[model samples]
Structures are given as structure tokens and as C-alpha cells.
Target: MTTFPIYQIDAFADRMFAGNPAAVVPLDGWLPDIVMQNIAMENNLSETAFIVRCDPATDGAEFHIRWFTPTVEVPLCGHATLASSFVIFNILGFDGDLVRLQSESGILTARRDGDAIVLNFPKQPIVAEDIPATVTAALTDAKPSATFRVASRDTDFVAVYDHASVVRDMVPDMSVLGTLAERGVIVTAPGDKPGIDMVSRYFVPAFGIDEDPVTGYMHCVVAPYWAEYSGKANVVGYQASKRGGIIDCTVDGDRVHLKGNAVLYLKGEIYLAD
Candidate 1:
């Protein structure tokens, strides 16, 4: 048997069980894709992140990272990336305040800012798009004011509503949403709470997640949209899931800096057959 270290972290939350939990595995080298998939399935969280150290001169990144859901590997993930950076900064004895990770999406950077970690990610630009009949039918009770799609990767549909209460009370039909061609759907509205600029919820049934508690990647799309709408470079977003989370977002040109806190929940070793 071989043992590998694993850490479960609640990203975007100040306390345990308040934000999205992700499993972080630091590896000496690459594992078979099937093995990683099995590990993700075993953890059964929204996402499991794997990291391998790389020579910056050769690989152009300090670490290479990948994110997997219980069912499939995704091109990008926000909360998991923050979790991995937490492990790197706190548990793994990383010396610097910033860590650069190479991923399928692109080069991503995480920096330590006081007690929070700021993830610098590419902004996912969105454009107005006609809502599909299936999506409209699925959200029959709470109709969206407008619909938009990510222009770059075309991964998710953005549904905009008039009020935060509509977003908070929405009950998505996962069965119908899972059949959509896109990876997921995001519902958002202007924030109703004090100090909050916007509110949102993410549903990615196709990737094996019905609703993500607090998503960082979803904010990559919504932050820019809200910034443009509110005319503010910095904004705070609250994800109104059962386990809520708060993210502070700053939009700078094509990049969005996501700032949040993470807490370690579990630390142990994974035993696997060699």
C-alpha cells in the first residue's frame, strides 16, 4: 500500500461547514486519470484538486493543478483552487505569499492578503442570449429578467433576476438542467443585504453537482457583469445556499481577483494499492 496526504478545506468561509468543501491532494508526480477520478468519487465533494510541483523555468508555473468533480474533470474551478492554495501556504510550507498554478484554463495565481487568499482569475465575459425553451420551462416559478451566456468557453448560462429574494427562493429542476448542453446555470440578482453588492447560486447537475454552496468560478462571470452594472470596481457577493459563503471580488481589466477565507476541516492520509 502507498499513502498519499489529503486535506479537506472549507473555502470562502471563516468557519468550518460554512463554505464549499474541497479535497486537496498534493502529489509527487502525476497519477493515472482513473485513480484521481476514483479519489474524487470517494471524497464526493463538489471538487477535488490535485497539485504537482513544477519547475517555473520549464513549466512556467510553480505548480500544475487539476480539478475533478465526483463524475468528471472540469476545465476550471474556483473554490478548489483556493483550497489547494491554502494547503500550499499553510500545510506544505510554501515560502512565498503568492503561488502560480498552471491549469487547463490557463495560468492562475493565488496570493496571501492578510488572513484571506486572493485568487486572480480570468474574467468570463458574458453576453445577452435568448433563454432556451427548456431553461425557461425549468424555471417556471421564478422567471429571469434576462439571460446571458459566457462568451469565451460557453460553459454556463447566466440567469438574471430583479430581486435577491427570487434568487434565494429558486428551486432548480436538476433533472431538466442536467440535460442541457452547457456545463451549468447561474442565477443572480442585485444584493439585498447590507454590504453585499450581488447574490448568486450555481447549479451544475451535468458535472454532478446540483447546487454549489459557494462558488468562486461562478463569480468570475458574475463579478464583471455586476461591476459593469453597478459601476463599481470592487464588489461583495453572497451565495445563498444552505451553507452560505461570501466572496470579495475586484474587477481589473480582464482579470477578477476573488478574495476569501478557508479553514481546514480534516487532514489525513489516503491508502491505495501500489
Candidate 2:
């Protein structure tokens, strides 16, 4: 049986229990797809991140990362990736404060800054597309001014709105929405809300999550899109899921810097189920 260390961490906030929680599992080497998938299902969080060695000479471990929800696998997950790197450098034995991850998304970097984990991700730049009528129905309160889509292959809309309240008042029909697009939908709006610059919400009724607390991958596309739209260099992002989180965002050329605090919640070992 493969023995792996697992961690539950809250990402995007300094205070414990205030951010999105993700499970991190660092493996000495790659596990079979079925095993990794099963392990993710067992952990049962918004996302569980699995790591395997790639080019140890580059760092200490060449890590291939994959994210899974309680129900299925996801293409990209920001918070979990941050949590995984934190565990490797902080909890595990990595010497430096940064770790490079070879993931589904591509080469990504995570840096430990004092007490927070900052992720440098490729900005999946968004271009405006025609707003579909189906998308209008999915976001009841806000109508998208712009749209972009991303699945594993083809992503869907990065729907934009005029105001945060429009995003806040959204009452999406999840049943109809869960399967709307291949890559699901991301709904966002600029926030004038106190304590935050912007507020957004995520839904992938199809991906088996009703809402994601703090989404790192979505912002890879979102930060660049908004930065261009607002002509701003930096901004704050808040995911309005029930278990919410605040993400600090900065645009730097082709990359978007996502900054947030992550707290370790639980740690233990898992023996593969025979």
C-alpha cells in the first residue's frame, strides 16, 4: 500500500477557518490515475491536490499536480496549488521558499512570502465573445457584458458585469446551469463593496461544485481580463461562495500574481485502500 501524507489547509485568508479549504497530498512518485482519483474522492474537499516527482534536479521534486473535487477531476485549481506548495516547502523538507509545479496548466510557481503563499500563473487572457442567451439565464441578476470560455480543451465564458451587487444578487438555477458549458461558467462583477475591490462567484454544476470558495485558476483568466477593462494594475478578488475567501490580484505581463494566506487545518497519513 502506498503511504502518503495529507493536509487540509485554508487558502486566501490569514485567519484560520476563514478561507477556502483544500487537501494536499505529496507523493514520492506518481500514483495511478484510478488511485489518485480515489484518494481525491476520499478526502472530499472542494479540491484535493496530488503531487509527484518530475525533475528533482530543477528543485527537489518535479511535481505534476492534479486537482479533484469530491465528485470529479478539475483542470485547474489555484487555492489547492498554493496549499500543495506550502506543504512541500513548509511542512515537508524543501529548503527554499518557492517551488515550481508542472501541472495541467503549465509551469507555475508558488512562493512563500513571510506568512502568505503567492502564486504566479499564466494569465489566460480573456477576449470578449458574444453573450449567449443561455448565459443570461444562468446569471439571473447580472448580464454579462463580455464572455470567454475555458474547459480542458475549450473554455467557456468569463462573464462580466457592471456592479458587484449585480453579482451578489445572482440566483442561478444550478440544476439547469450545472451542465450549461463544457468547462462551466465564471460570473464576475466589479465591487464597490467595503473591504474589497471586486466580488465574483463561480459555478460548475457540471463539475460537481455548486460554488468554489477561492478559485485560483479562474483568476488566471480573470485578472488579465479585468486589468485590461479597468486599466488597473492591481485589484482584490472575493469569491462569494458560502465558505468565502478574499484573493489579492496583480497583473504582471503574461502572468497574474494571486496572493492570499493559507492556514494548516489538519494533517495525517493515508494508506491506500486495498
Candidate 3:
């Protein structure tokens, strides 16, 4: 049997049980695709991140990372990436301040800044598109001021509301929305409180998640969208899920900086029969 270390981390949270939970597994080499998928399913979290060493470097962090949901593999996942960075930097004894990872979406980096880890991710651009009435109807009694579709490869519908309360109170009909887009839907509005620039909630039933507590990846689109409207490069977003979390966003040219805190929840070993 082969044993591997596994860590459960709460990403984008200041404390345990408050943010999105992701399982991070660091591997020596590539595991079978089915094996990694099975592990993600067994974990049953929003996402599980797997990292493996690259190109003749055993200890170097030039790693290749992949993210999986319970049911499917996704192109990009933010919280899981953050959790992976936390595991590599804090738990795995990496001395560098920045960790570079290669994924399906492209090259990504995570930089440690005091208590929070700042993720440098690509900015997803959005364009105004005609609202899908079906999506609007799924969100009953919560009509949006405007709606848009992401122009990037990971296409997600964006719904804009006038009030943060409306965005929070939304109860999307997952059954009706599961087939709407390739990724999911993002509903957002201006923050009601000070120091909070925007508030958002993500629903991706197609990806086996009804709602993501604190989504780091979606903000790649959210931060830029808000910046164009608010005209501020630095903005803070709050994910208004049951398990609430915070994300500090900064838009720079083609990149979006997502900064948040993560807490370690568990460390254990998983056995694989040889």
C-alpha cells in the first residue's frame, strides 16, 4: 500500500467552518485519472486539488495542479487553488513566498502576504448579453437590473441586481438552471455596508454544487466587472452564502488578484494499494 498525505482546508475564511472547504492532495507523480476522480468523489467537497511535481524537480514547486468536483473536472477552481497553495507553503515546508502552478486554464501563481494568500489569475471579460428569461424566472421575485454572459472560454451568466439583499435572498431553481451554461451563474449587486464593494453568490448545479460558499475563481470575472462599474482597481467582495467568506480583489490589466485567508481543518493519510 502507498500512503499519501491529505489536508482539508477552509479557503477564504478566517476561521474553520466559515469558508469553502477543499481537500488538497500532494502527489509524487501522476495518479490514474480515475483514481483522482474517485478521490474527489469520496471527499464530496466543492473541489479537491491535486498537485504533482513537474520536470525532474522532486522538491521544487514547479508543480502541475488539477481540480476536480465530486462529479466532474473543472478548468479553473479558486478556493481549491488557494488551499493547495496553503498546503504547499505552510504544511509542505516550501520556503518560497510564491508558488507557481500550471493548470488547464493556464499558468497561475499564489503569493503569500502576511495572513492571506493572494492568487494571481487571469481576468475573464464579460459582455452585455440579452437576459435569459429562463434564468430570470428561475430566480423568482428577484428580477435583475441587467444580465450578461462571460465572453471567455469558461462561460457563466452574470446577473446584476440593484440591492445586495436581493442577491442574498435569491433561491435559484437548480433543476431549471443546470443546463443553462457551461460553468454556472453569478448573481451580484453593490454592497450595502462600508468596506464591502460588492456581494455575490455562485450557483453551478451542473458542476455538482448548488451554491459555492466563497468562490475564488468566479471573482476573476466579478472583480473586473465591478471595477469597470465602480472605477476602483481595489475592491472587496463578500460571498453571501450560509458559510460566508471574504475576497479582496484587485484588477490589473489582464490579471485579477484574489486575496483571502485559509484555515487548516484536518491532516490525515490516505492509503492506495500498490
Best by the TM-score measure = 1
lDDT of 2 by residue, 1-274 (tens): 7577889988886878877889998887777877777887777678999887677687544577888887777767899998888788778788787788887667888888888888998777555566568767867844576676653346656677877777777888887776665556788887777757677888776766777777887777667666776788888778887778888899998788999888899999998755
Comparing 1 and 2 on lDDT, the stronger one? 1
- What is candidate 2's TM-score against the reference? 0.90
Model 2: runs farther than 4 Å from truth?
Answer: 58-62, 150-153
**Superposed model 1: Cα runs more than 4 Å off:** none
What tens-digit string does per-residue lDDT give for candidate 1 at 207-255? 8889999999999999999999999999999999999999999999999
Candidate 3 lDDT over 1-274, as tens digits, reads 9999999999999999999999999999889989999999999999999998675265334789999998888889999999999998998898799888988988899999998999999998888987678878897677788888878864788999999999888888899888864668889999998999999999988888889889988898888988889999999999999999989999999999999999999999999899
Clashes of 3: 0
Clashes of each: 0, 14, 0
- How high is the CA lDDT of each candidate model? 0.93, 0.78, 0.90
In terms of lDDT, which candidate is stronger, 2 or 3?
A: 3
Model 3 poorest 10 in a row by lDDT: 53-62
Ranking by lDDT: 1, 3, 2
The root-mean-square deviation over C-alpha atoms between each candidate and the true structure, in angstroms, is: 1.0, 2.3, 1.9
Better of 2 and 3 by TM-score: 3
**Top lDDT prediction, candidate number:** 1
